[model samples]
Target: MSQELGITVKKDQNPSEWYTQVVQKAEMADYAPVKGCMIIKPYGMKIWESIKEDFNTKIENTGAENAYFPLFIPESYLEKEEDIVEGFDPEVAWVTHGGDKELEERLAVRPTSESIIAPYMADEVRSHRDLPLRLNQWANVVRWEATDTRPFLRTREFLWQEGHTAHATEEGADEETMLRLEQYQEVIEDHLAIPSILGYKPEHDKFPGAKYTTTIETLMPDGKSIQSGTSHQLGQHFAEAFEIEFEDEDSETQTAWTTSWGLSTRTIGALIMAHGDDDGLRLPPRVAPTQVVVVPIYQEDNRDEVVEYAEEVTEELEEKGLRVDLDDRDHRTPGYKFNEWELKGVPLRVEIGPNEVEDNAVTPVRRDNGEKKMGQDREEFVEEAEEVLENIQESLYNELEEYLQENIREAESKNEILATIGKNRGYVKTRWCGKESCEEEIKDEVSAEIVVLPFEEDSKPATIQEKEDHIDGECAVCGEKAERWAYFAKNY
Candidate 1:
């Protein structure tokens, strides 16, 4: 492969450059004309489609129906929720004119749908029958962030599904919050093959106006942490602010509890950074756009025979319900095709050379680790490919799982926390006093903050701090009596 065509930088040496090279060289995405935005090319969009489809099914199963909301929201709507508006005010993009004329009331592009969705829920929800007003919208939002711009990671405009649900009781809202969070865990860990830490964001970092926020945080190969997904228990904040009152079982009007959860295009960035290598991307089979690619190796003399055999193998894999592509382009050489497919992170590649054609078999290559199985019977190869794909997926996730387990250092003091994070570039688990001032001071010093306070086994986030039976230690920063265990990390 040419230096310009293949990844130019080694992943371990320079992850940032390697990522940019893979995303662009492999034709996944390209930088848009505008700053802080990217054009998600076909390859990148396909991966996002996989994430959308998986999460959509899970959301719909929970009785949340898909709906569309306006892209431009009235400024007054956001003002209703002071915290939500304040949190996003710095990044909000405002529109003051309509084509040529100045508008009386300037509108704000939706950074998040809470302000708009909350009002709609307030109007639609009138009775107990509408207790669980579940609605989700797959849409694009704009946030005018001007720092660390990267494709899919910190984009100005990105696609995501924001779920807005209102429940009659706080318990119901809590259940809904945790339910969506667990589903996000499944999407990230099971389908994307990226292991993650599931927990509640510290009080200081919880989503604006949320009672608490649950998140799945994953570590990148470069040591920075990516917030893979988030679920927020909105409590009665939005509902009360928006006047989302409903008649209950006793016919009394009460404020409804609301929850909002979102998993965005950022997951695509996490997937690329998590599993990709120096060769290029190494997509997990389940979410890879093309699970298998058949490359026919042949000379001018045996071209017809080898190409036909590659098609036969492709058809066999397709018949077995695999997403297979037969690269029969006449101009590109077999070696070129292999590099292209490998760069695109096709999970499995079948090389149907002259020798394999004569043996009535194909050599299946695993993209994850470059393991090859030679001379397997054609019919048996399809069955074997299924097992191979599963193994590849499992291996990708296990590698990250082991990394996560090994790198989470337990710190007993402030210096230990700083040293651990500085040296290892991963999470430092420590006892925090649950004080915002202490957290602020620590952030000023180490540039790392409490990312999440993990729930104890069979414990809820609301009650975990109160239980106090599991851990007993002083605050790592202030030496105050510690409340619970939390993981701190430098983040993306």
Candidate 2:
């Protein structure tokens, strides 16, 4: 491949340019005519489909049913929840005129479906038996973002699954919230091969009408924190706003506690940035569209023989329950096919050439570490290839785990925290006095906000009591007895 055709810029030297080239050259996605919209090509869409299938099965097993809601929300309905309305107003895209005529009331394209779904949920649910309504939808949402329009990351239009649930009690709602977050962790770690830190969002950073928000955060290759997923406890806030109540066992009307959680295309962006290398995208095996690509290597004389061997290998692998593909395109050279599949991030590649056919073996190449080895026999090759893919998945997770640990630093003083933020691009773990003023002061100074408080409450040191920390002798910013340690970072 020519330099212009493949990635011209090195990831370490110019990551932004390198990323743009990979996305385009690999046939993953392209910028649309609109400013902040992207067209996900077949290759990218296939990868997304794989991810969706994995999560869909897991979600269905958890007793959640798929459902769809209207795309438009009337202004009056949106205004039901004060916090949600205020939080989303700036980003909501309004549909005012209907063709040449002005509508009686303007409608808003949903930035989220909370307001639109709550009313219908209230209407559909009438009794205590219908208390825990767990429904999810995979759809597109529009938000008029003012800046940052990277494809799959900060686009104005993005695809995602928004899950809305109503519970009988506050404790039930809270449990559901954490359960969803745990599911997110499983998907991220097992399928995406990305490690994440589970924690609670700071009050100032919690999701808009949620009583509290729990999140799973992952560190990208650039040391920036990406919120992989979030689950919110809506606490009767929207229940009262929308008056979603059910007749209880006692025959008394009681408000339902609600929760909403989502994972978006942004996770795709994170997967690219986290595992992708200077060569190209490195997708985990569980979610790779073509887990193993078979490349046939042949010269003019042995072309048919080599191609036949490649087909046999593909069939064998497929029978073993692997997603296998045979690259039998005659026009392209075997070297060219290898480069293409590498750029597309196939987990493993099987090369069957004339020499390999004579030896009754195949050469296997691993994308993760670029390791090449000879397979003893057809069965051995298939088993080894499967093992290599599993290893790559675990290797990617281990690499990211180390990166996350290195990016987080413990800061004991205000100046130290500021200095750490300036030098490193990730979270700075420091003690806070539980004061808004102190949080705001740090934010103003370093442009960093508190992102999460880890879920392990007892894991906190003895020096910290009821959010009070005696270690630093004072809050990082306020000079008061520090209450608790929290992770602060500049977020996406």
The candidate that wins on lDDT is 1
> What global local distance difference test value does model 2 have?
0.85
Give each model's whole-structure lDDT: 0.89, 0.85
True-structure Cα RMSD, model 2 = 2.6
Model 1: per-residue Cα lDDT over 185-223, one tens digit each: 999999999988888887778899998888989998877
lDDT, candidate 2, 1-492, per-residue tens: 867556777787787787778888888889999998999999889878877888888889987999998888999999988898889889999999999999899999999999988998899789989979999999999999988788887899999999999999987887788888888999899999998988877777788988888899988777677888899988899989988999999999999999999998888888888888888888789889999999988888999999998898899899889999999999988778888888888998888888889988998888998888875576788776677788989998998888888898988888888899888868898877777777787789877888777655455211112333424556777777765678888777
Off by over 4 Å in 1: 458-470
- Candidate 1's TM-score: 0.98
Which model scores highest in TM-score? 1
Q: Which TM-score value belongs to model 2?
A: 0.95
